[model samples]
Target: MNSLAALLDWYATLTPASLDRIAQFYAADAHFRDPFNDVHGVPAIATVFRHMFAHTEAPRFEIAERIEQGEQAFVTWTFHFGLRGRAYAVAGGSHLRFGADGRVIMHRDYWDAAEELWQQLPVLGPPVRWLRKRFRAA
Candidate 1:
């Protein structure tokens, strides 16, 4: 399979709802990283995912763009979720290294956790958001 297509297909199996499927896309000793986590092994990765899902709702992974060269691929994505019935969205990027097994052995993600999640909290939401806009405007 094309590395890009395989990477995306593997990512599609990883979501708040289908977390168990993540194991199928990773090696036993896979290394996984994201905005808030850096871990080794599929079980550890699953634990991190569980923690995230427990605290959020409707967390879906949408692949927005991708680039591939041989055994590696890069993907830009938007993670959608809701809190207190209000919807929120965050854009993130992931860099993936694939193994000959066609599974991801290493995955790293880059994004602003504070803005994507913490800033969306009830009391801090407005202030953080305002500050972000203010900073961007200044």
Candidate 2:
């Protein structure tokens, strides 16, 4: 398989134990960003994954689609996990730019934080939903 395909497959199957292999897919100076994090370098990336594992149970990814062109690729995915003993899923996508060596240099994830996360929380869910409805366009 090609490098991009391999990388996507690896990510879809990533686990806390496989985090040590992060360096193989991301460059030393890679940059990663999502709804809540903006970090650089492989070790920092690993730390993000570690934090995910620590806070959630059985976190896993399912890649729904991938589009690649030259050194850039976009992957749509769904993340599944258990938070506070309750299962939750968030649908998102990643925009990745690879270096000449095929290691990811920039990775940015796109997702709706309010709908996917904040609106699912026990204390914040109601208020967030109400606020959304109050200001939503008709």
Candidate 3:
């Protein structure tokens, strides 16, 4: 299977137990960045998902779209999880580049924390919504 196919399969079915396979999918010195994390190497990258599994309830990724060209690809997905008994779906996308070895060398995720996370909080939601509406074009 191709790297993108294998990577997406791994991610779509990711579990804490499957995390050890990180090395197979990413380069030894791979870089991973997201709204809340910026880490390098297999161990550090694994820790990010470890923290995710520990802190979130039933966290999962559902791939919505994928585009590949040469050694790079971009995939759009929705991260689903529950916090404080509330379920949230965060729409995000990652830009990935593969090394010559076919392992991902860089993974950068793009998403708006303010709109996707902060605005989903019960207490913070109201104010955030207000601020967005106040500045939004009608």
Candidate 4:
């Protein structure tokens, strides 16, 4: 299989026990950034996932769409998880650059915390909804 397919498959099946294999997919000095975290290296990247495992229940990612050309790729995905028995799914995308060795050298994720996460909360939801409506043309 191609490296991109292999990487996506690994992410689809990622579990705490499989974190040790992070080095196989990411370069030694890879950089990663997302809405809440910006980190470097495979170890730091693994720590982010470790924290996710600790804070959320049954967290998993599903790839929805992908595009690749040359050394760069972008993928849209949905992160599914549960919090206090409530299930949630957040849609987002990532831009990745691969190294000559086929491992990812840079990864950046794009998602809105307010719209995707905080807007799900009781207090934050109302205000977020209000602000969105406040800006809408209608």
Candidate 5:
């Protein structure tokens, strides 16, 4: 299968036990950045996944859309998990640049932490919603 196909499959089926296989999709010096993390290298990337598993319960990703052109691909996905005894689903997308060997060299995730994450919290949700309304264009 093609690298993008394989990557989508990997993410869809990702589990804490399978994190060890992250190296297969990322180059040794890969750079990965997301709303909450900016890290380089495969080991550091693994740490991010590890932290995810440590913090959330049954965190999994479902790929919603994919667009590929040459060595670059963009994917939209939904991340589902439980935190603080509550279930949450965060919608996000990622831009991936592949190396000559088909390993990901750069992976940047796009997500709004304020709207997608903090807004899900009980105390912060009200303030965030109020602020969004206050700043919204007329």
Candidate 6:
């Protein structure tokens, strides 16, 4: 398989608690960005991951589609997570740049944190969901 497919497959194998393997996929100088974090380097990236695993339960990453051109690839994915037996699904996409060794050198995700996750939490749950639905219908 191609490196892009291999990377996506490897990522799909990640579980909520697979910190070691997840760390392995990252380059030492890797950078990551998302709604909550705009971090550089593996250590900072791992910290963001630690926080995610700590808060999210039953996390699953599904690579729905992928395209590659040159050293960069775009992956469309669905993030599945649950908390307190309530499940939430979010569709997101990642832009990745691969190093010579095929590890991720840079990764960024695009998704609506408010609708996908923050809305599922305790205090902000209802209002966030209502707003998301309202705006989506407009």
> Which lDDT values do the candidates have, in the order given?
0.80, 0.92, 0.94, 0.92, 0.93, 0.81
Worst 10 residues of 5 by lDDT: 1-10
Off by over 4 Å in 4: none
Clashes of each: 0, 0, 0, 0, 0, 0
Query: Between the candidate structures 1 and 5, which one is better when assessed by lDDT?
Result: 5
lDDT digits (tens) for residues 1-92 of candidate 5:
23999988999999888888999999999999998899999999999999999999889999999999999999999999999899999999
For residues 20-137, could you state the per-residue lDDT of candidate 6 as single tens digits? 6655577898889988789888888878867767888877788898888888888999988887788889899999998887778899999988867788788898999888788895
Which candidate ranks first by lDDT, i.e. highest? Answer: 3
Candidate 6: residue pairs that collide: none
Model 4 over residues 9-80: C-alpha lDDT tens digits? 989999999888999999999999999999999989999999999999999999999999999899999999
lDDT per residue (tens digit) for residues 9-120 in model 1: 6555566667777766788899998867889999899998788678777766788888888878889998887766888888989888888877888999999977877787
lDDT of 6 at 59: 77
User: How well does model 2 score by local distance difference test?
Assistant: 0.92
| lDDT score for residue 37 of model 6 | 89
Write the residue-wise lDDT of candidate 3 on 1-138 in tens digits.
238999999999999999989999999999999988999999999999999999999999999999999999999999999997889999999999999989999999999998999999999999999999999999
lDDT for model 6, please.
0.81
RMSD of candidates 1 onward, in order: 2.7, 1.3, 1.2, 1.5, 1.2, 2.7
Worst 10 residues of 3 by lDDT: 1-10
lDDT of 5: 0.93
lDDT of 6 at 106: 91
